[model samples]
Target: MSTVHIKPVPVTPAEVIAVARESARVAIDPEAREAMARSRAFIDDIEREGRPVYGVSTGFGALANTFVAPERRAELQHALIRSHAAGVGDPMPKEVVRAMMLLRLRSLALGRSGVRPEVADALAALLNADVTPWVPRHGSLGASGDLAPLAHCAMVLLGEGWVLADDGSRSEAAPVLDAAGLSPITLSSKEGLALINGTDGMLGMLLLAVADLRHLLVMADVCAALSNEAMLGSDRPFQPELHEIRPQPGQALSAANIHLMLQDSEVMDSHRNDLAHAVQDAYSMRCAPQVAGAARDVLAYAETTAARELLSVVDNPVVLADGRVESTGNFHGAPLGYAADFLAIAAADVGSISERRVDRLLDVTRNRGLPAFLSPDPGVNSGLMIAQYTAAGVVAENRRLAAPASVDSVPTSGMQEDHVSMGWAAGCKLRTVLDNLGTLLAVELLSSVQGLQLRQPLIPSPAARAAIAAVAPIAGKPGPDQFLAPVIEQVRHLVQGPALRAEIEAAVGPLR
Candidate 1:
């Protein structure tokens, strides 16, 4: 139970995820009131002239050039939502919907989309009230601004689409809106275009991925410390001077984090002998800083793109302060779409490296003196062998998903949308990578903890010891193959958390 208050001020995607995850309420910033006033004034001016405006007086897409009868303008808005609600495949998770809603509200909060104030208010209310729309996961090229999926969202605004109501049950959007005493929004001028155009889907994916990446960064340090202890590898490679010469922010951060996690440990110091194992550690161990550092770098790039998107006004026929209507490419999603694919690739690497470590920890040959599969009985039980296999399978799946969706495009509306970012696919796959990465790291954490237990007499680094202690409540050493699933499930719970990492650091003092 938490509350994130957004005071109409612009917020980062990370902040938006925090608010959505916590079920927080949002209010318009008083500062933005001025912008809203100016935008509405421009809209009013356009209405008074009543001449011609794209999406206002005419049709959409293939019919953009056609003149729409004034009497059917409102009908056009509703029809646009219905016709575009072409999403298919599995419904998105409720959390994703919550995230989408938060981002949509944030985008509208910028007050540059020229949306009716009530529409934004309705979105915020849905978020605060926990009324999430049931959005399908597919059917968006991420061009034409996430049209299909967003239409599902907009449909709810018009008292249509499927929704999760107050009772936590699915219901028709119209009945739910009726129950909530809210009326559907009537399309005013370019309002229909404003509702569906933009990169919110991609924004949601990056927001979720960034949050996951932050946790993985901390877990990476913990995993490295554990692997270092388990394999008796030297911590000298993580020295500050080594990273200082290169002066990469992520490298320094990784070195510092690993240093902190391994500080003051008997196991770490014992392994400084530089025992000749292939003259150097495996790439997974030797190159932890490089690999994890690259991920951090990519995440930074994704964050920049996401921030710009959240603050952008992405819609057609953008209203100008002087009442000039301009149809522009503000709705282009290529930037975010590419960022999404790139970030997913980076995140997939996190899982790949983690799975490699898991494999090393399991194999008796490469695992130094640890028992085969970390099992007390080598022949009778094949402990943790299959865990590594599962990890490998997930890693391979993530690699497949990491292929950039932004590189592919298909034409639509007679080539009006010939080039698309496929942004929704990018966001969707990135989210999948986030889930896979979480599970991958969880397995590694579980294996590392079990391996550490095998070295009972010799203690790990102070920070590593603290992390083990925190997760110990959730996971215990496997007695046999009996219900290893329960132990694996705990990996998901403890490793992907800042609180657990903080607790470990508190006990260990500062990581290097």
Candidate 2:
């Protein structure tokens, strides 16, 4: 196997996902290290020269006017981390915590934050060693750069908070530091503020969401193909010339994916007889690409926005090479806030259509002679009847979460944090949508797979067959009214699996 070299040039959501899945270690580029070193030297010089600098000589938030006594500088740094570590609720998942560490390392690697190389190295070591800080799931207003959650992360670096170690044990950072033969990071100059003030917390969740959503979209196409065969729907909508008239990249790609998955299927050919009876398929089957395609466009937009953000230097009071410390709003998360909301909406749409296709497969009249509820015993089993309800409920919740987080801003920090983005909410909601979407699509997959089995002796597309095979080990065909929760969970895991997702993407190509 060839090795893939990941440069620290600019990380995208897809790249972040790839790194997370591949378990690749991250390191700062040499030039970026030099840049950071230069900025740190400049910050030291600024303090020595008795120059006034924001968040360095002066206080933070509502107290920006207060000057810090030289002797109290260390106290100021420690206080910053201790006070901001106010996040509460359940701990974030270990994978998410690791992603946050990676994003933070990358941003600091940009060299504008004036953080020490040791600080970046510590974060990198945490990721490389799989030592993840136990960050909470709530308490961020998206102003001051996810201050609460990020402070929890910074606390771990200071060997003061809890962390999940590689041995799958939760340990206090101080003890872990002793065990690992490491020391806590001491805050100097702008270091503590730099470590705590960034968009990494929100961006980490968004990056993971984007990765999972990409797979969901791909599986959605395969499910659509299976439903198309079961419904005996005309493939006219996917004709390249048909979409070329409008020429949406997403539409065109969706068309190609469906066409590929349905190619050479006898069931699709039999659908030609029905095409003469019906002019077009119902919106669910014929318009699958259009609906799923629009979401593809949205995914592209979200990915672009995240890529730009992960590459940005997001700490406050950026230190420059010329000994200038400019206090600005680089840490604000408005861009990612809107992008997360957009991603939530887009991912929810994928689930919405998947549920619709489930409806199409379950409706016997609409399903073209398939048994009711997709079971051997229709009245007795009630097969898949409530599955649709669960799928619908999840889709509804996603719709509720799609509301724009960037639009609602609450003031905090004595109104010094006024006009907040609440981006952490957006990122968290995006992940929720992803998780819910997995189940929703799993229902669709179960329904579509059963429908295809009813058409046995008539094959599905190669891509669809691979997906069915991947799911079979985890979720077999519905035999009775057995408990579906386990089956559904397994299906969700399969849907999120790398091989299954890659096959679907290879068949479908880039989501528009």
Candidate 3:
């Protein structure tokens, strides 16, 4: 298990993914510990002076004006955690919970949250012990951080709430903490606010989505190239000169990848100069780079937003280097909200265009020389006709999901937080959109491989041949229609995993 060291600076997206998805150990840096101690001294000084701070001495949200005596401050902090851990619905995936914990720990390590070093260490301990808090799917509005979700995680540090072990068995948190040789720490001044106030959940989802989409976008190009070959379509539109004139970086990259994938192809060579067959292919084949490239541009913009958010200090009443703890609106999740929504839209379009190609490959009129639905025998065998329908259904659902969760906001906290971010909802739905996209691309791969096999004697390019070989075991040569749902699932696994990309890259250097 690799370990990710957390410093006061921005952690990389790769580090977050490793810790979130790979059970990577997390270690706080010595510098970060020193920084946390320094930040804690300022809070201690304020406490000793009896100077009221927003979250330390006074109340939160709509109750900000209410002052709490020093004697009741501990109870105030405890109540905050208990009240905010109000999430409902099914528990979130273990990976998402781990990511949220890691990000919150990073925020504390940055020394802006005015938390004791022990608080941060407790989080690291839970992560190293593989004890994940059971955070529910609903309850976060994505404003003022992922309050309910983070509160559930904070509850684990207090020996309250439920947790999951490495084997995924659910149990009470206190026993798990004891077995792991960990002790729950009592919250101090502003610690509860620090724990729950940040955009970690939404930001973690955004970083994970960015990583997944980067790979899927390249795979989209691979699928588009294979579909083009299977349909005997022209590669003229993908010429470097054609894209160079327009000069959209992502567009040019997609065009170059498709052009490279089509190289050394007997199928393409057979139709190199056959103008009589057709002047050009449909938009699904000819304009793939344009659509896919636009998606790449959206992804790039989202990546930039996520990178900036990773470096931000998102807590209210952040401890300043000037020795003042001032409240700020950095916890608002609008930026991450927009990024998640934008990526959802981009992913939907990528799936949409891939579905179009799948449709064309199954249509006898559009499939060039292939039989209806890529069937071995038309009419008698329904073939992959239902498979296209499945892809279409997923695409429709994705379209509905792409309807921007960030755009809708309801006031909360007695209207003190009037205009919530809904960023968490955006991240959640974006996940579903990406999952559907994998299936949509899988359908395209399944149909294209069948069409290529039908074009037998004339082989595809080396990269295409490598792709066909990768999916062969999961989906054999097309024949009488059999159990297609299982085959689609198998192909989806191939599409989502690293093996298919590895095989293709092994044959053709690397793709952009």
Q: Go through the candidates in order and give each one's C-alpha lDDT.
A: 0.76, 0.79, 0.92
* lDDT measured at residue 285 in model 1 versus the true structure, 0 to 100: 84
Q: Comparing 1 and 3 by lDDT, which wins?
A: 3
Task: Give me the overall lDDT of model 1.
Answer: 0.76
List model 2 lDDT by residue over 1-512, tens digit each. Answer: 11112233556565566555566666566776776787788888877887778888888999998989877877898899999888888888777777777777777777778877878878766666656787888889888888888788889888898886555556788887777767788888778888888888888887787777776777788778778877777777788888999978887888888887777777777667653557877888889889888888888888788778866878898876566788889788888898888888878887888899899899888888789988868987899899898988888898998887889988887888788888998888788888898888788888888888777778766666767787667657756787888988888887777677676557645433
Model 2 off-target regions past 4 Å?
A: 1-15, 18-21, 165-170, 473-478, 501-512
Clashing pairs in 2: none
Top candidate on TM-score is 3
Ranking by lDDT: 3, 2, 1
Q: Model 3 over residues 464-498: C-alpha lDDT tens digits?
A: 89988988788888887788889999999898999
Enumerate residue pairs that collide in model 1: 8-29, 256-512, 259-512, 260-511, 260-512
Q: How close is candidate 1 to the true structure, as a TM-score?
A: 0.93
Expressed as tens digits, the lDDT of each residue in 295-333 for candidate 1 is 888888887887777667776767775667778886778
Per-residue error (Å), model 2, residue 376: 2.1
After TM-score superposition, the amount by which residue 45's alpha carbon in candidate 3 deviates from its true location, in angstroms, is 1.1
Per-model root-mean-square deviation over C-alphas = 2.4, 2.6, 1.1
Better candidate by lDDT, 1 or 2: 2
Q: Better model by lDDT, 2 or 3?
A: 3
